[model samples]
Target chain A: MTQVALMNQVVEWVNEAADQIREKLKSPIMVEEKSNRHDLVTNVDKETEAFLVEKIRTNYPDDHILGEEGLGDNLSDTKGRIWVIDPIDGTLNFVKQQENFCIMIGIFEDNVPILGFIYDVVKDEFAYGGAKTGVFLNSQSVNQVENVCLRDGLIGVNGAMFCHNTFNVRDIAIEAVGVRMLGCAGLDFLNVIRGKQNGYISNLAPWDFAAGVALSEPLGLKCSKFDGSPYDILGERQYFLVATQKTYEEIANY
Target chain B: MTQVALMNQVVEWVNEAADQIREKLKSPIMVEEKSNRHDLVTNVDKETEAFLVEKIRTNYPDDHILGEEGLGDNLSDTKGRIWVIDPIDGTLNFVKQQENFCIMIGIFEDNVPILGFIYDVVKDEFAYGGAKTGVFLNSQSVNQVENVCLRDGLIGVNGAMFCHNTFNVRDIAIEAVGVRMLGCAGLDFLNVIRGKQNGYISNLAPWDFAAGVALSEPLGLKCSKFDGSPYDILGERQYFLVATQKTYEEIANY
Candidate 1:
């Protein structure tokens, strides 16, 4: 399939998945703890992941898949066409506020991002595109963020990391104009892509940052490890930062 | 006029003011510094305040008014019927994000809250109520927040205050489940009113917290000074905190 056609198909499936998630919210939600009380998953998360996995398997049988809910194929290396899915990026907010959570998917060819989608279900905004086509929010074309200094822009932060002063995050926040935390990686990325925030910093798994990096790269954003190393597509939980190029340099140096 | 009638009138005027502000946002916004770079004001703020003040004076000329833009009546005492207005509660957000800013108005009769209205212009949600009438978000009734412990609920903190460790806010953030900062007092209050967040803490003037307190009182929220003293309705810039009773007690004691 052509890239545009494939993107359209993916968008349709995501809208369907979002519809199911919304319908499910009308009923009771059963939640379970993953690693701790802070790390949570709901029945809706599992169902959404399963539904998406089934669709991918039937349509793209040869593709490799990795999902947050572990319902997809597990691979040892980044090879061939691969899909990374985070069914619900903000499970805590999903269970608590039911509004800020998002569904994210990233398509990669040999570990290079080809296309990506981040669906903010409640807000009904789909941020999608990759390097070749450029980024977009729904039908509106998005531009690269303004290159800003650390002291001139708002930055999204992981609350726990900031509170713990992880990697001196507190100092970075102090240097920025302000800080905001939505507890959802997808929404944080959305803010940065829309130029509402200059950057976002957090400790994230591959699924948490995959789609974000795909959408951000085309907008001149810099995404890397806390120590300024390039990202490992299949890496585990690690300190991650994505920001406007200037802001990234300032934070890394600070 | 009856209390309900007054509320309806205020709601109509606020909606009109919001319309004007939205129209103005489409043009170039003229921003100016207040106290520092962090403290901002804009032409829209002044225009919105003037618009609302005109509506109030033409209708209820007997009532005194206090406004953030200083376009309203000035008085030494909180006597008689008075209207308090913050044309744009989060001017910084208004100038930066344009999505989180809000219009707020409060009605006081003889130093007691009679009605309040907080309009999130972009979301088009109006959280309005008072002591005699229960709070409502648009048309839906809003209930009191759950009395969760500090460690179990999300709390909103002022970014500057939290970073500076003002009143040991960093320690308080460490004790909560997590922290969120939206850089908008009105939106922060709306989150607490809707039970999405347990509490919010910041330094605010009378215009900043006036409408929020009126709506919160009907929903059984506890609003007080950082020292746990009762709020002074006409107070100036001070440390303010609002939350569920349990969360209030926990944060105050801690």
Candidate 2:
């Protein structure tokens, strides 16, 4: 199938799977801790990951999967088609607030992002993109917003990013018009796409960045490492940057 | 009327007004810049403020009104019964995202908070409190959540508080379980009442804190200055503190 057709199929599947998972979460779901007490996981995450893995394996037999809940393939190489999945991004937000979380999936071919989808289950909004089709919100094509300067922009940042004696994120925050932290990576990415925020930065894993990178790139945004270098899909970093063309240029220079 | 009867009446009025505002916002509303390009105000905010002001004037002619849109009284004195109002607490959020904003009103007699109301227009949820009545959510009485240590508690902070390097705010954030900035003081107060956050700190104006203090104080949460002293209702200070009983003590000592 063509890349556009494939992405359309993936979007439909994602919506269906997300709806099923959300239904199951109507009642209190079992939660587990990962890494630390702050990092959490719910049964819905594992269930959704399993469901998506099964569907992807059945539909695209040769595609490899990298999922958050350890329910997918652990491939060292990014050869061929690979699906990076975060069944429930913002697990803490989900477990605590029962909102502001989402399902994220990104497809890569030979280390190049081919397609990305971020689905907000509570709001039922989908932000998707692919190299061939550009960016879209729930099937409607959306153009890149006008380039906004830092002084006129709203930025999304993780809490840790703004702390003292760290990477000096506070200095960067002061330059922006305002800063917000919603505690949900998928929602944060959607805010950037919708022009609610001019840019977003976070300490993210591959699952967090994969779908965001795909959606952001097609909108003429600059997605890079904190130091304005190309992102490495295999390496975890303390910071990721997504910004409008004007803000990106300013930040890159700063 | 008794204080309970009067509060119930005010709650009904606020809910109806909020409903009207929400309906008007459903259609496209004109947006304009305020102090800067990043600071936005929508026609909904002005209309909502006018609606509430007119209602208060017609219903309770004796009460003095203090509102954000410059539509209310301009007196500096805090004599007599005063009604402090913010038609829409998060104007930027309302204009940009159309969610996470609220209608807030605080009624004080002789500078003592007697009634407070915060309505989440999108969710149709109301949170209120006062000396006569304890904090409540959607009419259900709610108890103050037990105090937990900062290391085990979530903190809601204005992103600027940590980023400006103004008051050693970053160090305080690092000592909490997690830090969140939702851009709306009213909604952040709701989270605190629900125990989603242990406390929040911000440099808020009178309208912003008036309703929140009404809801917070009777619930046994500490709303004070950064030094753990009482907050001045009319003065704009650098910082304000709100925390659970135990968390307040721990934070004050720290």
Candidate 3:
């Protein structure tokens, strides 16, 4: 099968994984602390990751995987076909609110992102596409986001920006119409894709952004390091911002 | 009619007003800047407020009304039955996202809050009731929110907290698991009422919080000034915090 054909199937696989999560939510949740009390991992996240890994190993055995929940193979490089998966992107949101969580998957071919899928499990809005298929929101092709400037748009900022006052985020809030934090990167990315938010910026890991970058590339949006550098999609926790070209330029100058 | 019957009727009125908004959403949305670019008002807000006032006056003309959009009577005292209306709380969310906005109403009897309604218009989740009828989520009686301490629970902070770091909010984020900002008080208040969040704090005007204060009262949550003093609900730009009993005390001490 062609790469696009394979990715069409990958979207279905993502939906199946979302089903597993919704099923797990029916029972009492069992949570375990990951690095500390602030960081958390739950059984559903592990289970979902296992499900995706199993699907990939069965269908595309040669593909390497880098996943958050340790259900995938350890890989030294993003060579050949690498699938970066965040089975449950916002576990804290899942455990606490049972909302604002999503499943994100980005499949790369020889270090270039070819397909991306982000399923907002609760709202049932799936954003999927690639360089070949173009970005889609629930099978509908996504149009170009409006070029709203900083003063006219809402921006998403993580806790660090507020707590540390980084990038003058406090003043940015005043200069911009407002700022919001949804506690989930996928949702923030989705908002930017939908033109509801001008941009989303965070110090996030590879899996947290690969799918978003893939989806955004075809929509005429800019996905780059916070300082307007090229996105190092394979790198670990890095400052990232996805936004419209105008907003990106404005923020870059600011 | 008894107070319960009157409140039930008020809930119906709230629903009627919500239906009006849902209908108005089909047409083109008209928005006007209020005071500044950061603040906004939409045609839906004025229309919803007019609809509710018409309903109230048609049924209970003796009652005075205080509303956010300046569509109601001006009363010196909260004597007699008074209705507080925020036709579109989070107008920015309404105009930008159309998902997070809500309609809020609080009914007071001789300066005492007796009934409250917060309808997440798009989600169709209607939260209403108060001290006499008990708090409710879509006609279902809501139980008490868990008494999670400030450290263990998620909290909601508004833009001012981040901009000014007031109440040591920057450090407060470190003390709690994390924080979320929805840009909509009704939604944040709904999260707390659903036990998804421990509390919400903001510098707000009278109409911004009157309904939330009424809805939270019966849920065993404390509604107070951020300093833990009694809430002066009718005041403008007062610091308000609503939370579970334990969380409230901890925030007060912190």
Best DockQ goes to which candidate?
Answer: 3
What's the TM-score of every candidate structure?
A: 0.97, 0.89, 0.97
Alpha-carbon deviation at A122 in model 1, angstroms: 0.8
How would you class the docking of model 1? medium
* lDDT of candidate 1 at residue A164, scale 0 to 100: 74
User: Across residues A37-130, which tens digit of lDDT does each residue of candidate 2 receive?
Assistant: 8888888998899989999999999989888888778687879998999999988777766777889998999999989999998878898977
- Candidate 2 residue spans exceeding 4 A from truth: A2-5, A23-29, A164-168, B2-5, B8-44, B74-79, B122-124, B129-146, B165-167
lDDT per model vs. reference: 0.87, 0.82, 0.85
Question: DockQ for the candidate 1 complex?
Answer: 0.68
Q: In model 1, what lDDT does residue B97 have?
A: 86
Tens-digit lDDT track of model 1 for B134-179? 7889978888777777777778998878877888888987777667
Query: B1-254 in candidate 3: lDDT tens per residue?
Result: 88789878988888888888888888889999989887899889998899898888998889888889998887777679888899999999888887788899988888888888899999888998888888889878899888888888888998778667798876666777879988999998899988999989888877888899888878888888888777765567788899889888877876
Worst 10 residues of 1 chain A by lDDT: A227-236
Q: Provide the lDDT at A8 for model 2.
A: 83
TM-score of chain B of each: 0.97, 0.94, 0.96
lDDT of 2 at B62: 86
Q: What is the lDDT of residue A152 in candidate 3?
A: 85
Q: Please give the distance, in angstroms, between residue A195's alpha carbon in candidate 2 and its true position after superposition.
A: 0.6
Candidate 3 residue pairs in backbone clash: none
Better of 1 and 2 by lDDT: 1
